[model samples]
Target: MKAMLPESVRATGADILLGNTYHLMLRPTAERIARLGGLHGFMNWDRPILTDSGGFQVMSLADLRKLTEEGVSFKSHIDGSKHMLSPERSMEIQRLLGSDIVMCFDECPALPAERAQIAESMRLSMRWAQRSRDAFGDRPGHALFGIQQGGLEQDLRAESAEALRGIGFDGYAIGGLAVGEGQEAMFGCLDYAPDQLPSDKPRYLMGVGKPDDIVGAVKRGVDMMDCVLPSRSGRTGQAWTRRGPVAIKNARHADDPRPLDETCTCPACTGYSRAYLHHVFRAGEMISGMLLTWHNLHYFQELMSGMRAAIASGTFEAWEAEFHAQRALGDIERV
Candidate 1:
């Protein structure tokens, strides 16, 4: 994945990529990576990398995890080794990794919980945000971003945003949605959630979704987002295009001579046909993943570039209309 950075990512105009604090800490250990000259040297990619604070992973991936006022303690899923992640520790780890963008350590409560429970969780996250800020101190070029967490409650979201603003951060992330909240409910929260943050700073939507989800979020004023959808979906034989998803594993593509998308200039579309992609995917060839992942990443960057250009030229609405209209066409009517 790191090897693909130059052509597949940077060439396509993506300047930043997200790194998982939890997974990195577990595998090579922060100390090892730092000893080897930090993440850039370790990964051989000099671009900006945003590191999450490990709070969400502790809640989701760790085994026998225990949350407390100070932090959380858990056993690693890789091994039964014990570990702890507090706001201070999280800050230290990101600093050790030499991340360009460090996220504040904050609790993310799963949705469908009672309003009272969500409120309590959001309040706790606010306190942690302050601690994260304090622990982060002053890094010359590096930035620390605060996270706003409040289920779907508008009042709670406003309150959380106020708390983050009071503490102050280089950027703000709207968290706690996309856990299980459907797109409509998530968009409803976004309607007011992003507006609550400082408009001057970048507004990042964490774990935000598909092409449509990204389009909607950008339209609603979110400046940054991160998700595993494109890469993961590509590995699973799913391709995202202007016309929507195309499942390459489906029988319909087995003998199709056309490219995945006629307008796409990526290697997948330019060098291979739908039939070749389907054959390789069905045969479990590794290139199947590489080509598809490249195409997906290229497509996402194209989408971002289009949005940025549209917004700069004061024609975002027209660009967005075309985006949806293309999707409405629906994958070239099944080949």
Candidate 2:
């Protein structure tokens, strides 16, 4: 797991780490990880880690699972073996993994769904939230987060938020968004969604987005968010830079001698030329993914750092304007 992001590299920029409960629960298994001292020990990451409830897998891997009020019955994608993931089971798995932040098990209905369908899914999730709470019990250093799932319905969002508040959790997550909902719609929901939750608690927007999406969510009061875009794109030879995404495999970069981004301080940018990165990726070298992934991660960290500074200085708007303006300029032309 740390092959792409070693703790040493990730820690230098990341404030925290996120783990996939679904995958870990399936492979290596939660019991094995627990015996080995949990995810932090197994992964060699000392920083805080947040693990999802396996609810996303219920939605994403719908074809491989059956949904019911009790829980999801999944046929292992790896070996076709059967496994059940209920609220109680999810809580137990997170506990075994020793996650600092655990998410409540909740069904995430895909977007463009009927309001009736969304309502049904949300209510079920609320029920599971209670079960998750009871199963988690009281753990001193651990925190359980309740997820609000109502699709794009304002009233349902409010209802879901209130239900979570009634249950009371260490934190709250705005789930069921960014699941094929356009950015405009996601932002529309966030505009009122975060306000619906406890102001003092952290508001996590689940499975969110590109650079612009991150900025927009932060602007709308989303306390935190998660996405796989940076690393995923990096693996495909794309680089997320201040100026926008750079396709490192492009022929133009094959002979270019410039840094991916002149201003970038990442090792890939500082220590290698565009030509070298281009060559490795084209040659199918493993380091191609490693270097670009590190660069992309570094750029994302820098983006957040800039936003935090701008927010503190009351210059967020100015910083945002510059961000868009720089991206609009596009990748530097051969000059």
Candidate 3:
């Protein structure tokens, strides 16, 4: 919704929205949003909204951030204002934002770290998870989710999951992956991580990825995922389609009159041609981003719908085979 209209996002069949607690809290202030009737009212989005607990942003984006047993203290990137985000504070912020699904405040360490570091971070996050749960208290409608943060260590992951389960939550998120971890490493972890959590509750893979990554995560038992790739790529003149990723700014599209994808029914494909898209992108028109973003989100939702149907019908193996085969064909042969 930040890059495009909520109506446009809804048109793409996105049932839920993810809001950044760090951004909203720092800029607009969570208190201000509460007066404006929370994020759903402020953003005019009535659907489910999941708000991360601001742990990742503070750890990665904040200037001169310091991590401690209590919480993280840092200067905001926006104004360099001093702030602290403990588990209790994170819970309070999410409540003020009126988030339907809230993630526990948990530390996510960078990958390629020593096992000891990973273990230490995971233990700290587990403690924070319990604190987050306690602070969240009894919100009747809002659901708090516990985040698992064990980096890539299987034993640590199991331990983290066990901790979260003991504390209890509405859902479980597999965090600490996708933080500089390559697909192979991530996939290796996913092979067992999802299973470690309870099968009854929702299993979310946070900050997950492209089309193939989504497919792989789903196949490995992930129930939900969220990413900025589609919208981000859209703004950068890229589009994701059934065939594969398409660079819309390429000169090859200067004269071609084909749609980004012949099979796509998005506004970008059905109503505009590659030449037009390329022209708008090169011309630096704002509609360029909107069109591509709409197309990418549409394609992603379609892919998920396809997978859901295939899974229901017990034909996922065949569906997966065909999905790869389609991408292998690449974009249409030279316009």
lDDT (CA) per prediction? 0.91, 0.91, 0.93
Who is ahead in lDDT, 1 or 3?
Answer: 3
Give all TM-scores, in the order shown.
Answer: 0.97, 0.98, 0.98
TM-score of 3: 0.98
Weakest 10 consecutive residues, lDDT, candidate 3? 55-64
Q: After superposition, how far is residue 190 of candidate 3 from its true place, in Å?
A: 0.5
Q: Which tens-of-lDDT digit does each residue in 47-84 have in candidate 3?
A: 99999999998889534798899999999887779999
Q: What shift in Å separates residue 19 of candidate 2 from its native position after superposition?
A: 0.9
Ranking by TM-score: 3, 2, 1
Q: 63 in model 2: Cα distance from truth in Å?
A: 2.2
Per-residue alpha-carbon lDDT of candidate 1 for residues 271-334, written as tens digits (9 for 90 to 100):
9999999999999998999889888888998998999999999999999999999999998744
Clash pairs, candidate 1, are none
Give lDDT tens digits, candidate 2, residues 39-157.
99998888899999988986688789989999999898899999999999999999999999999999999898999999999999999999999999999999999999999999999
